[model samples]
Target: MESQLQQLVRHTRVHEIVGDVIRVHATGVALGDLAEVQNTDDEISLARVIALDRNLASLQVFAGGKGLSTDATVRFLGRPLDVVYSPNILGRIFRGSGEPMDGGPDLSTEPRVKVGGPTVNPVMRVMPTKMIETGIPMIDLFNCLVESQKIPIFSIAGEPHSELLARIGFQANADVLVFGGLGLIFDDYYFFRTAFEEHGVFARTVMFVNQASDPLVERLLVPDMALAVAEKFAVEENKRVLVLLTDMTAYADAMKEIGVAQERIPAVRGYMGDLYTQLAQRYEKACDFKGAGSVTILTVTTMPGDDVTHPVPDNTGYITEGQFYLHGGIIDPFGSLSRLKQHVIGKATREDHSQIMNAMVRLYSEAVEAQRKQAMAFELSPFDQKLLRFGTLFRERFMDIRISMPVTEALDLCWKTLAECFEPQELLMKQALVEKYFPKDVGPVAVNEAPIHG
Candidate 1:
C-alpha cells in the first residue's frame, strides 16, 4: 500500500544521466534516501539520493546506469540505505551491495539496520585503556594497538600490506572481525578468504567485498556495511569488534569518480572537498561504549608512488589516531606510531613494558647511526662494532613481518638481544628493571634458532 506521501513524490521523469548518476525533477526528496528506479522494461535498480537542489534530486544508481532510460520511474523509499544484521551473518561473505556472495542460504529476511548514522555520543564513550595484541612484535611490543583506536597502515604498491592485515585479522585478540575489501583484485580477495578459513577464524568473521569489476558506487558502501555490523555486535551482542579495511585509497577514488560524474567542483588534486569529513565519519565509528564492548578500526591506506603528501593519506593522517608505516616488507619503527599507546603502555601491560620499549628503540636509533658511519667508511670503534651487531640481530629477529610472538615473549627476547651485544650498565634503563629482567646467563644466540611463534 503506497502512502499519500509516497504517491505524491513518485516521478517518471529523469531529466539527465551522467555516468551512474541520474537527475530527476522530484520534490520532497531527502539526501541519503533510498529509491527504486523502474526502467521502461520494468527492471528495478536501487539508487540513493546524493544531492538535492529545490525540486531537483541527484541519485547514484547502485547497479550502474548502462541501460537506464531518461523516463525511468523514480520512487523514493522515504528512508536511508540499510544493511542486514544478525548472528547468522557470521562466517558469511557478502558483496558490497549487501547481497550474499557465498553460495549459501538466503538472508534477505533478516533484520536490517541503517548505516552511516551519527557517531556514538561522546558521553557514552569510555577512555581507551585496553590493549588489543596482534602477536606481531613490531605492533604489540612497540606501537601498541589500543582498543577502540582508529589507525591505518600507510604503504605503497609492491608492499605486503595485505599480508600484514591478514596476519593481524587471524591473530588479534578480538571476539569478532569484520573485513571490508575495497576495489580488490580477484587474487587479493581469494587470499584473505583462504587465510581466514585455513587459520580457523572464518567462523567469527564477516566479509564485505567490492572487486575491481563491481560497480563504483558499491565501493563506497563496503565500509559502511562492515562498520554497521560491527557496531551491532558491540552494542547489542557485547562483543569486541575489529573492523579491517584494505586500500581505502580505492574508496576515496570511487568518491572522486562519482563526484566528477555529478559535475561537482573538485578540490585538492581532483578529490572532493569533503574527503576529510567522509573519512572521519567512518573512522570515528571506532569507540569503546561505556558498559558495553568496543569497536576498533584498522585500515590500509596505500600512498601512491610513496608520496606521503598524497590527498588520501594526508587527510587520513589528521583523522586517524596514528599509522603503521609499512616499507620494504617491514614495519619501520621510526615511521610508525600509536598515539594512544600511552594509555596502556604501563597500565594494561607488564611493569617492564614501558622501559623496555623506550630502551630498545633508543638503542636501535644508535645502531642505525653506526651503520651509516660504517657505510661512509668512517673510523671504527669498539662500541660502533657492538652497535652494528645489535642492528643486524634487531632486523633479523624483530623487524621481519613474519615474526609473531606474544608481547611477554617478545619483551624477553628484546632483553636477550640487548644482552648479546651491550653490557648491563650500557642500557640506560631503570636500574631496578635492568637488575630484574637483564638476561643472567647471556650467551650467543644460535643462528639456526627457530623464529618466535605466537
Candidate 2:
C-alpha cells in the first residue's frame, strides 16, 4: 500500500542543488511538504520544502547533499513534517528527525500530528500562579520557576549546564519532561540517557537528540519536535509538561549556517536578521491553557566567549520572562531573577517566604560590599564583620548547586542562618515574621539527605 502511494506522487527532476538544499521546479508543491530525494547513486534521502515560489520550491534535505546531480528525482509527499504522538512516546528516545533510537517498537501505527504550528492564543492561556519546584534551593527558593514560564540558563561554554538540566528533569515537579539536546557530543548524549535511567525519570521523559555528527538541518527540528509532543500532552491529556533544551547557542549557530546557505543577509553578530522572531516562535510555545495543564520551557543558552550581547542570548533575554545566570558552578542569586515568582512566592508558600527572601538577598548584597571594602583596606565596622560572616555561611549553605531541599526547608534554613548571624534588632525584616519564623536558639543546619547528583 505504501509503495503504491509513493508511485502515485509525481516526481520532479532537481533543477539546482545547494549545500544540503535542493531546488525543484514543480507546480503543486507546498511549503513544508515532505519530499524524497533519490541521488544518482540510487541512494534515498528525506527533505522538507522550506521555501516555495510559483514553480520553484526549495527543500532542505535531512541528509546532507553530498552526492547528487540533476539526474536525481525529487518526490513531494504533499504534507509537512509530522510525528506519531501517543502515550507510548512518554519513555522513548528519538533522533532529531523523530525516528525512534531506543530499539523500541515502531510507532508508525499511532496517530500523527504536524510540528511547527502557531503558538497558543492569548485568550486560551491561563495566568501562571503555580510554582514548579525542582528541589534545588537556588531555583525553588530564590528564583521560583513558575508554571508555563519561559526562561533560560545563561552560562559560558565548558560549564555543567547540562548536568544541572538533567537534575531538574529528575527532580522537577511536573507530569512530563521533554528534553531536546542540540549539537551535543556523543559523550554528552550518553550522560543524559544514563542520568535519566539511573534516576528513574526515564519513565516520564521524552528525549530528542541532535548530535554534533548529525546533519546541521536536523538541529533545527529538535525543539519543535519536543514542543509539538509536549503540547499534545498538555492540551489533550491535561498533563503539566516541562521542556528543556540545552545549548541553544548551537541551535542558533545551526540557523545561521542554514541562513547563510540560503544566501540571506546577516544581522547583528553575523546571525540571521529574523533571529528574534525565530526564538520567540519557540519560547512562546510555553503556555498554560485555560482549565487545562501547562507547558513550561527551561532552556540553556550558552553565550559564546561569555558575551551576553551575542545574538542568541541577547534576543533570548528579551523573549523570556527572566534568566538564570549560572557562573562559577552556582546559580548566582544576585544575577538571577524570576518575573513570575511574585505570582506564587507569598501566595503558595509560607507567610514568611517573601520577607525572608528579600532579607537574605539584601544582606548578601551588603556582605558583598563589605568584602570589597575590606579588600580596599578600609576600616571595618562591627556590622561589616557580621556581614562578612553571613556571606560565607550563605554561600556554603544556600548558593551551592548541590544543596537540594524543598521550599519549606529552605525557608527554615534561611531563618536559622539569619538568627545565627545577627541579633533580632540588627535584622530589619518585619517584626512579626522575625518573631514567628526566626529560630529561638541557633543550632547546626540540618544535614542534606538528598543525593548530590540530584
Candidate 3:
C-alpha cells in the first residue's frame, strides 16, 4: 500500500535488541510513531518508537523482540499509536494493544483515534458541581463521587477492591463505563466481564485488558486506550463516562521495567523521574466539557506493604483529587475523603444531608474512643455507652461494603441510627433538621434492647 518513496525509506539495519526493545539507525522517526518490523520470513510485527538519540532510534516491539533478528526491515509509520473509537466498541473487549478480543466482531474497519492526547483545555472544562451517585452508602453519604472528579481507591493485596469497583461500575449513575485491567489474571478478568454482563451494564461498557501474561508494552497502553475511548464518548457522543482502572501499581511496574531496559537512570524507588507527570497526564483526562458530557476516573492503587509512603500511592495522592481508603473489606470512614464533596453536599443533595453526615461521623469518632476505653477495661460513662451503641449500628448499616441504598434512604437511616442511641436534642445538629428528620416514634430505648440488623 505504500508509495515507492515510502518503501525506499525502509531501513534493514537493526543494531541492538534488548528485551522487547530494539535499536536501529534511522532518520525521520519521531517518538511514539508507529513502525513495522518485517523479518526475513516476511512475518510482520508492529512497534512504537520510544526513544531517539542522534540517528539511532529505539522502539518497543508490540509482539516482543525474542524472535526478531537484527536484519529485520523497519519502516516508520510517521504516526503515534491509535485505538479504535466508535460506538461499535461498546460491549466489546480489547487487548491492551487495541486488538479486539471479545470474539464478537471485527473492529479493524472502525475509525481510529490517537491515544495519550493532551488534556482538555481549562477554558473548555466545566466546574465539577454535579454528583454521580453509586448506591453505596459509605460513598454517597460521606464522600460523594462528583462528576469529572478523579480519585483513587487506596487498598492493598487481598482486599476486595475489585468487588467494590465492579459494584460501582454497575451501580454508578453513568451512561458509559470504560474499564482498564492492568496485569490481571484470567480469573479477575472473567469476574469483571461476568459481573457487568449479569448486571446488564456490559452492553454499555468497554473493557481493555492487559493480563499478567501479556507483553509489558501493552500494560503501559491500557490506561491511554481506556482514557482515549472515554474522552471520545464524553466529547463526541455527549455521554457521561466513568473510567475504572484497577492495579495501577502494575502499570507503574511496567514503566519501571521498560526504563530499566532502556538503561535510564532510576529516580526514587527505581521509578522514572516523570512518574508524577505520567500519572497526571492520564488523570487530567477527567473533565466536564462545557457544552457536552463529562469523564470521571476512579482507579485502584494498591499500596505495597500497606505503606502510604510507597512511591505509587504517594505520587497518586498528589495527582488525584482525593482517595477512598479501602481497608478491612470496607471503606474506612476515618481515612476516606472526597475533597469535592463540599461542592454538592447540600446544593445537589437534600437540605439535611450535610448536617446528618457531620453528626454521624462525629458520633462515630467518639464511638471509636469508647471502644478503646472498653478494650482497656476503663469505667464507661453513660454517654460512652451511647457512643458504643451508635458505633455498632453505624458499621452494620453504613460501613459494610455490601450495603446499598439511595442518598435519601441513607440519610433517613442515619437519623434512625442517631435516634436509637441518643436523644434528638443530644445530636448537636441543626435544630430544624433534628425536628424534621428525627424518628417520631422512636425514643431512647433500653441499652439491652435488641440491635437492628441491616
Candidate 4:
C-alpha cells in the first residue's frame, strides 16, 4: 500500500509529449501553476500549466520537449509563474524567464509578483487626459500619444522601427519605462541596450528580453512579465509607467506554433481562435488609475509583407486606440492617428495647437494633390506653386522622423513653416489665431522668440 503523503503528492509519468508540450494525467492541477518535468536521465525542464481539463493537464515546457519518453515524471510546483519585482530590477536586464542577464547581483530576496495577472478594473480606470510627449514632431504636433493609450507602430520588414522605438524610449517624458523585446535578433537587442545606455535612460528602464535564440515558448511570457512589473509600479509605487513591447507579431506566432502542437483547431492564418482576446488581455493593461498613476503601452507590431489584413495587425487594430504607420523611414502623417488625442489637445497644450494641426494637415493634403498634378505634366498655377513649396518645407521640418523638439517649439515651428509658404490671409485659420501666430516679417520667426497667447 502507498503512504498517505505519497498518494496525496500525485507524482505521475508523462502521458504524451508533442513538440514543446507534455500531457500529464494528474489530479488537483490548476492552470498557470509551475511544474517540473524530469526525464529518465534526471534532466529537468521547467513548464507551466497552460490547460487543464478533468484529470489531464497540458504543460508547455520552457525547454523543447525533445528526447522525452512517457516515463518522464511531472511534479506540480503548486505556484504560478512569478517574476522578481523591486527597485533593483530597474537598470538590469533579464531573460524572458525573468532571470537577470546583466551580470548584476541576483534578486533572490525581492518580492515576486505573478505574471499575466488580471488587468485593472474598468471602474478604477480614469479617462486619459495627459499627453506623453516623445519630442517627435509628427507625434507631438499631429497624433499626440496620450497617457494610458495603447498604440502600435505598423511597419514592414527592412524599416527603421527599432530605431524609432529606441528614440521614444529615451525621449518620452515618463517616470519609468518597462521594455519587452520578443523574438529580437542579437543585433537589435544590442542596439536597444546600447542606445539606452548611451542616452543615460537605462537607470529607469527594466528590460525583459526574449532573443531569437531563446526558447520559443518564452516569447509568450515577455510582454506579460514586463506589464506585471509596470502595473506594480503604477498601482503601488504611484509612478507613471510606460511599457514598450516590440514585435508582438512574433509573440502571436509563438502562440500559433503551440496551438498547432497541441492539436488545437486553427483560426485565420493558422492562428488560434481566441487571438483577439489574447491580444486584448495584454493591451488592456494600459490604464490610468483614478487617484494614483498610469500605465501607457506603446508596441511595435510588424505587418507581414506590409499587409494590414494580416491576422496579427488586424487583431491589434481592434484592441489599440490607434496606430503609427511607419513607411519610407518616416511616420506617415495621413496614415497615423490617435483617438485619445482630442482629450488633451488645446487643453494640455497651447491654445492654437488644435487649429494649427488641422490647418497644416489640410494644406499638406492640397500640396500632395498639386504634386500629383505636377507629375502628370500639367501647368502649375500660382497657388499650385505655393502648395509645392509648402510640401517640401513641411516634409523637411515636420514630417521627417529626425525632427525632435519640445511641443512648444514644435508649435512655433509650425507658424514659421506656414508663414514661409503662405501669407496670413491664405492660411484660412481663425482670424485671431492667424493674426497672432503669422509672422509679421518675411523671415521665419526664431523657434522660441515668438509669443504664444491663450
TM-score for each of the candidates:
0.96, 0.95, 0.96, 0.95
Which structure among the candidates has the greatest lDDT? 1
Pairs with backbone N, CA or C atoms under 3 Å apart (clashes), candidate 2: none
* Candidate 2 structure quality by residue, lDDT tens digits, 204-298: 99999999989888899999999999999999999999999987899999988887777779988789999899899999999999989999999
Poorly placed runs, candidate 3 (over 4 Å): 1-9, 444-454
User: Candidate 4, residues 90-185: lDDT per residue as tens digits?
Assistant: 899999988899899979999999998788889999999999999999999999999999999999999899999999999999999999999999
Whole-model Cα lDDT of every candidate shown, in order:
0.92, 0.88, 0.91, 0.89
Better of 2 and 3 by TM-score: 3
Task: Write one digit per residue (lDDT tens) for candidate 1, span 1-454.
Answer: 4565765457657899999999988776689988999999999999999999898889999899999998788888878889989999999999998999999888989999998899999999999999999999999989999999999999999999999999999999999999999999999999999999999999999999999999889899999999999999999999999999998999999999999999999999999999999999999999999999999999999999899999999999999999999988999999999999999998888899999899888888888888777778899698877777777788888988889999999989999998998899888889999999999899654343222111
What lDDT score is found at residue 12 in candidate 1?
A: 53
Error of 3 at 230 (Å): 0.7
lDDT of 3 at 29: 66
Worst 10 residues of 1 by lDDT: 445-454
Off by over 4 Å in 1: 1-4, 444-454
Q: Write the per-residue lDDT of candidate 3 for residues 180-206, one digit (tens) a residue.
A: 999999999999999999999999999
- State which candidate, 3 or 4, has the greater TM-score: 3
The runs of at least 3 residues in candidate 4 whose Cα sits more than 4 Å from the true structure, single-residue gaps closed, are: 1-9, 443-454
Residue-level lDDT for 21 in candidate 2: 82
